[model samples]
Target: MASAPQAQGLPLFYNDLQPLSSDLHANYKIRRAETAPFLAKQHAVPLTVEEFPLVQRYLPIVFSMGDEPVPLGLMGLNEGINVFFDADGKFRENEPFYIPAYIRRYPYMLARLRPDAEELSLCFDPTSDSIGDFEEGEALFEDGKPSELVQQVLKFNEDFEIAGQKTNAFMKELKELGLLMDGEVSIQPDGAAQPYIYRGFQMIDENKLNEMRGDQLRKIVQNGMLPLIYAHLFSLNLMREIFGRQMQQGAVAQQEQPAA
Candidate 1:
């Protein structure tokens, strides 16, 4: 998953915001997100439907463990175990984890100007250290107008919102087609007596997907959903990899713990 725009609640570190004004934000700037403590979770993060292919290579594409079934890119096999990120809540130097667009678009998001307003306004998380006056990074405004960097962020947010809408529509199709089902994965550690059983998530049921009639299948194919489904299927194989990494991480942690 290359995004998390549809999470049930607000993303981590984004408490609330005040409107970004040229007058009020003349000196605000944001550093590169790569090293920022932007994400603290090792759990699966939201992913737009379109991002499945890109992230499927190294991450498992699964739905949220909750009833509301949203697509997620698994950074770890279980909660509190994002193997890709290091202890400092940062991606390992040169590790090349595919950073989600959700994380990249931090501190800035589109929101309604008012409760009943039909229009959206660009807003910023004023509390973010990534924002605020900084002489070293790209500025939000210049000469009381939005700077080029601000314009770029606005465009990215706009496109992300559009993609989010498409993702919602895709999810609706999945629900209507009865393609979603409970997820499970079983793994046996070497020399272990029992296999670890994993569940509590939603996934595409291959059986049901294959049972669709010719017309229904054709409809989805024409809608360009077949590849996305295949990407998901292929990505599921990475679940075992995530589990193995978790085990490795466990061992590393144990070794690093100081003696009592």
Candidate 2:
């Protein structure tokens, strides 16, 4: 099976992929995450296009830099800092954050059987603590067949895969239309002397949209791309909110630290 899409310090703890089979994994149980401490260090998390509306209300969404530009929800602006997660990787301040399905589909990923093969197999990261050796959690298999829980995970993965395809296609169309361009954002916090300048990203060029031919605009609208583009633009405001959250949290952390 194709390995988890590799990136530097990304897709955390998903190493040593093993294709799910009844023989080897029948006894395997996954420990339900009581806390999301794993997410504490993450700033950006992969997001599906379908999640734009829900996520926009909570966090700014951006495109990851690469040939395949995956949609990413900006959990924090700086590296190794996620404002959404607390010290224990749980939600901060007991506030409700829209958990992206991508994060929810942790440990298990639908990987391709072969490079050229269209078929996909359910795979899990054996290294994850979520995958358990204990008999208390839900079983991966029962009667030598995938259990109900396994089927649910599989369905979730399948839906994720389908959404991924749609996002890819949308990105491809954006590229073809030359609508996406290099993006940057600058944020100046209340007490910071220097503004934080973020670069090396992609965003829809509104100027280009303004210059677009009427027919082209209609075509994009027909493709159901307009709302998504607007959603992204509208969500940019939340970046400042995220920065405020970060500063507030940073202060709290510093206050809690024992002085040298």
Candidate 3:
């Protein structure tokens, strides 16, 4: 298994409006892998005693086209993980983080370019109990109408490669802009042949980050963080704009504020 720090080095990180030294990139990757899982477990389903080891052993690879292994941290493989916010934090999970469009298309891509591999599976954590259903919030990338949010994220990832960026700086920008949000993943255990839910960090709002100030935000923008941050920001902004507009129009007058 790759050590946490070793794994992070594979992904590039931007800093000071320029990509950071290779050494710094390595540090961020390790940090992400070590920290992300703890966050995922917060929103994941509770693991039964028997399932603990499987959950612990499996680590999640946060998806980003720019960074080969975008380590958004780690998550348990089984149910009972979740996302949380410190009392002083600025964001909250208003809704479950839906799977991205690119991920949905991966199964087909794998089938078309079948490779000799030991094993392959899609690991995710679903926020809602209705794990079997993907009717709503399903992202389909076809006919040039890929999920708008995902498209933006992919672009941001590409920029990271073009410009060279660092990881910690990118995350700092994400937090400052409020683009990062709680996310969920559903994983299929090695032998069970069944899918299970686990929770983790995800990109929610995009535009809110536009309000952020200072060179820190600029550094993140210059780095590859643009794609992930923008995707999350757009998603959250879209939801809020739609819902907020609906409420103003009296579409759902009795709705209550989301729980923190």
Candidate 4:
């Protein structure tokens, strides 16, 4: 989803967006994805704050770098690497991995039709193999109306949009409080001359949080922002685990190279 852009300025995993209309796509059928090959090489997946508790157990929750930083769940530490998913984007055997909702909502999203559009329309990627005029799969429409599956998909997307709002609010608070700082993680393997240092991300500054005045700290804690921040901090411990996974999967080479 992160590599090889198909459409200019499009969201991850989307090549082209078309409104889901019964008139236009009445014959379309939605095929569930058995393997999301697009995600095979993606190292980071966007995450909503609502998923912090569950996702922290599987992926390191860190904020992305740049002006508009968003939460990202690290499937691997470096670019073009994923530990839990195979090359075909299927979960590894016997491994209980938590799939982010962002990945699950791929090929379908709510987008504004025009620059000044007030409401978002339900849209799907035309290039995706998951939805189209297929002989098999669930029907998207029934008798010129949206089917049950369509209803469910819309509901899920709506919930995702709400979660995105909450995540944005959480990020705004963090930024306003100056609690985020450039993130770095270093891993030193046995007998290695130099440690592999991973950088180019943002993270919560614990010192800043600890040094905050009582009123400021109480505000975040009362607003339920503290737990998500702690969840992100706790999840940082998984960086070592992910590095070890990359080693086991042969994703990291023996030669010392900086990870960006």
Q: Which has the greatest TM-score?
A: 4
lDDT of 2 at 183: 76
TM-scores vs. true structure, each candidate: 0.89, 0.88, 0.23, 0.94
Whole-model lDDT values for every prediction: 0.77, 0.78, 0.32, 0.88
What shift in Å separates residue 103 of candidate 2 from its native position after superposition?
A: 0.7
Model 4 lDDT per residue over 166-237, tens place: 999999999999999999888899988799888888999999999999999999999999999999999999
Deviation in angstroms for 4 in model 4? 14
Displacement of residue 160 (Cα, Å) in model 1 is 0.3
Clashing pairs in 2: 36-89, 37-89
lDDT of 2: 0.78
Tens digits of per-residue lDDT, candidate 2, 1-260, equal: 01123566335546567789898877888778777766877788777788898999998877766676767788777767888787778776666668998789888888876779788999887777788678688888889999899999999999999998998888888888888777788876667555767766677899998999999999989989899988888898898888788787772122223466
> Which candidate model has the greater lDDT, 2 or 3?
2
Q: Please tell me which model should have the higher lDDT, number 1 or number 3.
A: 1
Order of the predicted models by TM-score, top scorer first: 4, 1, 2, 3
Candidate 4 stretches with Cα past 4 Å from truth are 1-8, 253-260
> Can you give the lDDT of residue 176 in candidate 1?
88
143-224 per-residue lDDT for model 3 (tens digits): 4344454455445444433322344444444455555444543433345344443333353443456665677577666765
Clash total of candidate 2: 2
lDDT of 4 at 16: 86
Best prediction by lDDT = 4
